[model samples]
Target: MTISKDSPDVSVIEDRRLSCGVRLLVESNPSVKSAAISWWVPTGTMDDPDGDDADGLAVLCAGMLERGAGGLDSREFNDGLDRLGVIRNISVHDTSTRLSASLRNEELPSTLELLADMVLDPLMPEDGLDPVRSLCLQSIQGLVDQPPELASIRLNHLALPAPFNRSAYGSSQALESATIEDVRTAWRTRCLPEGSIIALAGGIDFDVAADILERRLSEWSGGSKEMPESRPRIGGDEHVEQSGSQVHVEMAFDAPPLCSSDELPFLVATRILGGGSSSRLFDHVREQQGLCYDVHAGYLRRRSGSLCTIGAGTTPERVSRTIESIYEEIDRFGSGGITQDEFDNVMVGLKTRLMMHGESMAARAAAIAADFHDRGTPRTLSQVAREIDELSHRAVDDLVRSHFNSKWASGVARVAVGPSTPFQPRS
Candidate 1:
């Protein structure tokens, strides 16, 4: 493995590339005593060979990763983590299955080694497969009781393109059809070094952390499976009929990708539309009119593209009007553009948020991993805050003018999960 630093001035951030192709990034903050690891493997729900037929196979594979690894059985594997005082999570996402672990500064070496073992040499025990499969199924089934979450998932399914549109919850059919061998093969083939990222943040030395990973993952190798670029394939208004007292609604429209010039301005505009209690959506839809139990809108994205999302939960009778109100408010915000007052308020809140977020070692760790994947370089909070601080209200308002106008409805998709929702689409 070869290592490099950003520059003498920004020596805190470091980067390393393993000969096998895995990339490692670390941001050292010496004041704190805890370190975090945000590891992203290239395999995820979208990479499942079984597709929807055996959709949850990747997730199942992730669960099996926990059952045992690196010569340790399930029990012993977990015991090792406890001994090192590690707080960890491993789960499947759209483009990458992520593993996050946080431990004391001193525990960094052992914890990272154990985690490396988990990924590089997971036992994937036969006895553990059945239980893991059941848990995956239970999560899918549990979605029935989580209407808002289900609404968002369904919306993503409808608004995005195929293969890439799949949710992390593998369908029951896929889970049942998948065998142990299938799960093992999926991990083996997809768990390659290419496109993988290991990011660490907090009180640690980047050189030392990089050295530990370099040695631990020296043998890991493979090329990244090329990610095909996909265009928007927006679906029409859809609803899921489930017995419930309230309706969960979600609306989505494509936004600029992280790489686009329009990305920053669009991000600012969406926050004004619905970023906090003071946002237009909450202030108008929930506080002023009392239309729903809760309402908010925000931005979300994958590796290449992004979406501007609006979500709400409301009573059955009020569902139609709530949806209509949301649409009108979005249109109004776009048409009228934002005021100087709104722009100033948003900037202050956003800047404050950026500042507060910088305090969390775990958040920083995960963010850099995603950044390396999406932007090809890690960005410091100071860098991000400076960019935001430099933005003029006119720039964001101009984007609002061109992007957030009636055009938002042209490609918009809405989803509702409840006993009853208005079948007819709203303009």
Candidate 2:
């Protein structure tokens, strides 16, 4: 399919499907010399077939794919990408694994072919499994010493249900027992054409890209698998005793899921609450009260569910005070709502970020792939900005009231890592 780049308002985005059912999304930008491609496979840790025992199998499979493919050894495969002057990376998350590359526009065909080989013809060798498994095990072990990460993991496990709660970096016990066959089975069962999206950005011809991908992926085929059902909101509190002078606290609240009508309002509310240096959490908790060394809130977006997470790090002596101050601010924001100045400031910050991301080919490619996976279509900068502008103060206030009020706080999931102390929800 050819997209006309004649009109300034017309987006250069084009979509097509291959014979094998792999979806291809491309955005043509003639102004840039470089192009980026992202191959998004919709299977993640949640799709781990071995249940809790193979927690990190998806991650392990991603690592193994990089080790060898198309009859080439690990070194040979990497060297081939280097020869093309391509920058490559692989990311494994809760719901998907993305293999990405950025290279000169002229190299798009060669790079796509190489990526196809990596996904369709990976040579998951027996000798490669041990090393990958060792690396994964080490990562899991390392998480124990990192208080913040440990606390977050514990909170997710306690708050979320099976598979969704599983970490991308699998458990130590799971990796230790994982074999090459397990990784291969994961690839065969989950990594299929039906649920995959190949997003391309920067200087490229859509017809050529579509043709190259169609011919290369035509022979690849597999059955589509249904994603796991959405789990209920699990809210509770837990504290773990760890020998340390500094304490870590993570609090999570249920929020709107991806592509929901409340998504924009919730995002605006979260930013006003704890987005940056000028946010309420930073100004009140860290600056005014001096209760925490670091405190911030993030909106985690996912297919099945989403969360509004607030975390703080403080000395053991001030841990309880820090927790109280966080809740206090949340209550204050929810009750009084945000001022127009605060809302406008957050909008400016969000717009600046969006503009910056628009300038990079790699960022655009990744964003398009994620949008396609999450919303079934790619969103343009104008569309997103328009949506942000559509959110009024009253709408944002309602969102804050519904999702961050004291009533909501009563059911929050809390995780604290440090010398055990009494930390409970305030009435």
Candidate 3:
């Protein structure tokens, strides 16, 4: 494991073609007292094929992986993890499924072994099917229960077509009909090696950890598949239905993706706009004018294009005023742009926050994997810091002009989730 000149503070060790074509990485955070092991399989919601039942299957497989593995039943697995003092958890996202655990240095080996077994082998019992399917359905239902969450999902549905915008968590009650064969097929295809990225970070020595993983994971093998690239499609009518006391207004417009160099400015501009209570939206809509309870702006970075969003909540009487003010702020930044103070403050906040994220070994490992996945090289913290430092007032203005300009930023998809009659935008 050689440290790149770019990021000496972090050491990345990668093992490719170990049996299952799995890619294992170890990112050492020497200063941290604990370590985290993350198993990333590139099978996410985007990988789901309609009628193939792959999405629900992958999710169910992830759920049952920890129920029992390697001669350890649920009780044994639970007891061993507890005794070892490990924080074991797993999640399946839009792009990948992950199993992660954090533990003290002394307990790393056993925990790693346990995690490996859980990933490599699982006893998916027939009785276990109902609960796992129910849970997945319940989660989908929960999202629908929250108007804001549901609104976001609907927005995604409008933003991207088919598998691209499809719910990673799968649809409601549909999982109830998913068969054992469906999950088996999903596990077979989605959990392949070439798309996998395994990352570890912690207090232990990189060589020893790598050796442990290398010896254990050397037998895994799977064929590599080219990941599909899809673009974000944003079209359709903007609707604001009345559902509650205050009107929840949400808007989304197409923008560039994460891989773009322009992402930095997008980040900076969004922070200055409505990242926190001190932002333009917060100050203008909630502070000075007192027209709304909250206001913020953000960009949802996807594989193809991203979505720039600005949202707010206000009384029926104030909704129109709030939207007007929000739009005004967007126009203001698009034209006059941000001052040096605004840019610097946001950068300072962002840089400080980025550094803070490095405090955790898990974060460091994931960061390395994510950077490597996107750009094929992980950037050093100093380089990133320097990049932020070098961004000038002129540069920010240029960025806004290039990307946030009204013409470049197409169609605003707005949704109002509240019970205030049909929402009509203020002219």
> What's model 1's lDDT at 167?
82
Across residues 1-427, which tens digit of lDDT does each residue of candidate 2 receive?
Answer: 1111221344557889888988899989898899999898878888875455658788899999988888998899989999999999998887789999999999999888888989999988899999988887888878768989998988887667656887778877777877888889888778888989999999999999998998999998888778787565456788888887889999888888888899988988888888888999999999998988899998888776688889999998898888778889889988888898988898877777777877889998999998989899998666766676667888887777666776676545888888875475545
Error of 1 at 400 (Å): 1.5
How well is each residue in 239-313 modelled by candidate 3, as lDDT tens digits? 646455767777788766786777787778888888998898899789999998888888787664477887776
lDDT of 1 by residue, 1-427 (tens): 1111222234356888977788889899888899999999988877865344657888898899989889999999999999999999988888899999989999998998899999899999888889998998899899988998899888888887766778888888989888899999989998999999999999988778878888899899877688855655557888899996889888888788877778788888888988888889899999999999888878886664578888888999998888788878878887888999889998887777765656778998998998898889988776776677778899999888777755665555789898876758555
Global CA lDDT computed for model 2:
0.84
Worst 10 residues of 2 by lDDT: 1-10
- How far is 340's C-alpha from truth in model 3 (Å)? 0.9
TM-score winner between candidates 1 and 3:
1
Query: Global lDDT of each model?
Result: 0.83, 0.84, 0.70
Instruction: Please list the Cα RMSD from the true structure of every candidate, rounded to 1 decimal place.
Output: 3.8, 3.2, 3.6
